[model samples]
Target: MPRLSTRTRLLLITTFPLLVLFVTLTWYSHQSRQEEVRAELAERGQLLAAALASSGEASLMGGQFDELKASIYGMMQGDSAIKRVTLLDASRKPLVDVEARTSGQPEARYFEAPIHKRLLYVTGGGDRNVGTMGYVQVRMSATALLAKQRRRFYIELGVASLGLLLCLSLAYRMTDGFAASLKSSMQALRAADEEKRRLLQRVNTAVEDERKSIALEIHDELNATLIAVRLEAQQITALAAQAQPAPLAGQIGDKARAITRLALGLYNSGRSLVRRLRPEVLDMLGLQGALEEMVNQYERNHPDCHFALQAQGDFAGLDGNVAISAYRIVQEALSNIVKHARARNATVALLRRDGRLEIAVADDGVGFDPAHTAEGIGIAGMKERVQALGGRFAIATANGTRIAISLPLES
Candidate 1:
């Protein structure tokens, strides 16, 4: 036979105890029934013995014994289960003997008969003070009792078997129902996870598209207009340098210097805005150049803090998503370091090993509990972006805060 399923095994475990209980009950019931049958048979035997004793010798001489014997014979004639009845004297000598209707002849001495037959012996009553007067040996066929007990046993067995089968069937149905519900719940959870992933992908795509469009607008409209204004300012400065009147010369020089400062500030602000919209250097000069420019700008802005960047291997052919995610992660990490780390020095490292890319941003700062500080939006956003690309993100602090991200080359 094949092994049982888990549900079946569990059902059997639960049912075994009940099975033992039922069997014990059935055994006790059978014992009680046997005791009741034996008591009934003993009561009938005592009644017959008392009736025989009440008749006495005068009734025996008046042919009353013969009539009583005829009545007993008539009553038991139809019952094939009554084999024979014999009356014995105090000395154990036979006084009367009756054979079943089927037995052709009676044996003169029952002692000469076969010893294998089982008999029931009832002592005939004489007086209360006297001992047993004589023995009434009755042979009873056990076939009827045996048949009754066999039928009862079969009925009990059938009922017990049906009950066990019913219990097992109910148990199986319950387990199957639970399993189906669990399977459906798991499928729903999986569908929800897939939906979230697709939604994130669409959001990322839309954001990138908007950034590209804004960058193009800044380059075409803003940069072009600024250049025209700068050229016009240069013309004004040249004309001022040639103008007569020595007193107006210093005023013209001051006006020219103010225009120069205003023009430089506008140009620098536009460039910074365009770079924030989209890092054009990332595409033209690759990841290394873009990272170096980003670090230089940050270091210049925070003169008191030291920022260092190191790169191993050329990432010129890396996928755009990989390059962009790495760059954004570094950008967000540096921003957090400036805003939260309170550090004097920070390091950003990028390395490619065994066809995988690893980015680490570390700072010698007053580190806080990661679980508590993870509420920051910048850190959370970086983690989401990295994970969306099937990368691993981790932040740890032994001596200081260190954020590490790793992504497969293919992704």
Candidate 2:
């Protein structure tokens, strides 16, 4: 069977037993009504027999058959339900028989009463029957009793049906209210989730824009100033080369050289910071070339640790959003490895597989348990960024730590 909703399930659970109870009660009522009808008819029969026996006592004793017949016929006329009224002698012989024929019907029910004569003296301080006179037998048809029961059944059926309908209506209203409440709650939750996603996406875009702006300022203004300072230092060294006093000239030359070295270091540091903020190469070279350049930079910076990049398929057509997320995720993973993983080697893999772009970064390092370690903001931000692009992000650590993320090729 197909699944039923809460309303339907509740209706079945609550109403099935009630239906059974209704049927049982209806049957009981029918049986009780039948019994009552039979009893009422029986009582009426007994009363009529007793009355006829009393009235016909003298006629029966005096052998007045005509008088006995007249009394029975009179009673039968008064009550058409009385099908037959028979008077019998003490020897059970029928002296008078009066029957009103009801053709084409089943045999009527019979009720009998014994006739007795009172003695002149009472025994045990009470009236006593001295001798048997005769008996009165009355037969009654069940049609009238059946008719009463039918009417009673119809009335009971109507009442029960009305009660059942009322109960079902109440149950339906209750279930409808409950189901509606649940649906409202679910819709509210869905709306809240959608709003949260939109907010996160906006935040990610704003942060990226800020990074790009800051990177541009550092690269264009700060690096230009540092380069000018280095050039001036070189000019001062050339002037000191021809100084009058040799010692003073050497001292001035050394100072100028030191200034030049310091300026060069500062300029290199600023460039590194700018690259970390936003690699300009990412915009110029696309994801695959930028990733390869990043790997080469890492290898040159940390020659003690091996770094490798393996990229398949052209990433020139990748969306800007996906490219940035992928690059940032890989950058974060590599930063983590450099800072924490006391490892000898690391690998970055970028591949297009099954219409999706998959990136995997692995390091042969002293892996720490992810469950025991709290994730830093960088990792959390990367996860959010990947998810914002409708991608999956996951990290695992065993013999080595591995971070993997996948984004749909469409975006």
Candidate 3:
């Protein structure tokens, strides 16, 4: 046998038993109808035979054959099932015979009743016995009864079949609905899995981009400072070996001061690079103060746009992951506004409400339609990151764009 689908198996499991039960009940009903029909026919036949024998007893004994024959034929005319009736004499000779219409009827059955003399006298009761005077026989055909039984059987069978079909149809519909719902859920799960993979790829890309940026900054700023310091040291060595030391002491001192200045610049460059890699400000000043410093830096860098921060919570003991993500999200949002949105004013909000960190970045700019436009790497990556941390993200745009994020604080 072929393997069945879940839907097919469920339907079979539910409907097979009902089908069997209905069929059994239908067959039983047909048999019971047949029995009842036969029983009724036999009772009717016996009654007709007994009544004829009693009514014709006097006429049969007086040798009045005409009156007895008239009585027998009259009953036969009224009952169409009476195929034949016979009046027998005491010597077993037929005195009268009558038949009713039997056109298109099946084989007949027989019922017999006896005719007893009305005169009864007792002389020696112990050993004397007398038999019945005469006999009456009736033959009946059950055409009508059998026809009724068949009609009843067919009607019952049809009803049972109809009920079975209805039940099966209902069960199939229910299974179909369940199968459809299950299919939809599976499709949704597949889509979510695909989205998760795409988000991971984007995250890796973002990391590579950050590394490249940091490498470029170090190469351009720190290397040049180190080369300048090396040139100053060589000059100091040349002046030290000079025979006229007093005359060139001022030159040596100037060279020493230049090297000192270059060393200080190189130190500042190293600190900036370290801050970019892992914000030590978050540890020194906490999340709120770090965010304040970040916003102040953005204002200084992007002089064309004004920025503000509204941080209203004790972010002293926040989870490290949540704090870092929140910082990156605000950083990306402000960069997007400065680069894409031709806006003059932007705001960043960080509030701790009900054991959760809520962050919102809003810019009064030429906002783009989210439904029509595809999200850029920054926004998409930010949204995926928040969701990965079991947080919610949303965006709204009318006069400006607002990206809202809510993160559950870890205990």
**Candidate number achieving the greatest lDDT relative to the actual structure:** 2
- Relative to the true structure, candidate 3 reaches a TM of 0.47
TM-score of each: 0.54, 0.56, 0.47
Query: How well is each residue in 276-387 modelled by candidate 1, as lDDT tens digits?
Result: 8788889988888888888998899987679999999868799887787788889988998899788999999989887888999999988888657546888888877776
The models' CA-based lDDT, in order, is 0.72, 0.85, 0.80
Query: Clashing pairs in model 3?
Result: none
Give the clashing pairs for model 2: none
Clashes of 1: 0
Off by over 4 Å in 3: 1-267
Top candidate on TM-score is: 2
Candidate 3 accuracy as lDDT: 0.80
Better of 2 and 3 by lDDT: 2
Model 1 — which ten-residue stretch has the worst lDDT? Answer: 109-118
Q: How far is candidate 3 from the true structure (C-alpha RMSD, Å)?
A: 18.8
Q: Clashes in model 1: which pairs?
A: none
**Model 1 TM-score on a 0 to 1 scale:** 0.54
- Residue-level lDDT of model 3, residues 1-411, one tens digit each, is 899876787778888898788878877887888788778878988998899888878778787878877776777677666778888877778888877665735345688899877655586544322557888888777776677678877887788788788888899999898877867887899789778756764674577468557756666667666767767776675665563666587677667667767776776777677677667677788889988999999899988899999988788888766777787788789889998888899999999989899999999999999889888999987977787666789999889899999998876
